[model samples]
Target: MTAGVLDEAIKKAAIAWISVGDGPAYALWCMPAESSILVVSGPGEQFAPGLAEAERATVRLRGDHGGLILVVDATVSRLTPGSDEWNELAPPLATKRLNASGTADELAARWAETGCAIVRLTPAAGSAVGAPDLPAESAAQPPRETPARVETRRPFRLHRVRKR
Candidate 1:
């Protein structure tokens, strides 16, 4: 896809799931900025521990089609706090994070206080692909009915008494 289209898609996508190697991945609350993807990892959020040392990963973008728009082979980089990069990226990150916040100052302050780090992913071989197809039968089944009563008030007895 063209850079313009890619940027637009990333900007509109609110969440992206990142995968490294064959390990399990977690969702990222990320946004498109400066030709890269910016995501935050801290307390009370979902993020893979591997990303801290990962060299490359794939960023999955759910497409309008019934499939995924995968941006493959993205180089992972961490943006240090209080740097020029952080200063510029933080505003857009805060706005995207608190998408509904009337003001960003409070959220930004809280983010700093809570020690949040912004990780950047630069697409090396950006690609879009179809989502894996699964049979309808494989879908989750509804819960089955349960018994009406689970316990009784009578005390437990190890042995039954003979007719008395």
Candidate 2:
């Protein structure tokens, strides 16, 4: 990806309309620290079985013209700001944005309150792994940001996923 594209991706936390080749393809991605999710959309003929490993999962399309694959690697930590010791781990620009208008301690505290961590991903020079150019007409827009407001509410009823 170009520097411009990478900057956009990092700023938006997602990319769309990337072009890999002369095949119909598009991807939507979300990266929150150690976890990143990607959804690939393309014709079936372009699909291929993705590589699977101990820390990775690849789901491939299962029909004619279904050549698309969704490859997710658990080992690659998604880059996150204000978490996972980002000040020391992330690139300088990422650190600055994450810690913007706040002290390092303050940012760290915020991340802790949100139950988040930071992880780094390699092949990171560009924003994404593949370069599939998408047209503006087919791209997805980012969600609108909601203003923060304080509200009073009762505590949640207790539900346990596992008993100690």
In terms of lDDT, the best-performing candidate is 1
lDDT of 1 by residue, 37-77 (tens): 88877764445667857788877766666245545568899
User: lDDT tens digits, residues 49-84, model 2?
Assistant: 221111323211111232221222233333345444
lDDT measured at residue 26 in model 1 versus the true structure, 0 to 100 = 61
- Model 2 whole-model lDDT (C-alpha atoms): 0.34
User: Which regions of candidate 1 fall more than 4 Å away from where they truly are?
Assistant: 1-5, 99-103, 126-164
List TM-scores for all candidates, in order: 0.64, 0.27
Candidate with the greatest TM-score versus the true structure: 1
Candidate 2 Cα outliers beyond 4 Å, as residue runs: 1-75, 78-87, 90-95, 98-101, 124-137, 141-164
- Candidate 2's error at 161, in angstroms? 62
- 119, model 1: CA deviation in Å? 0.9
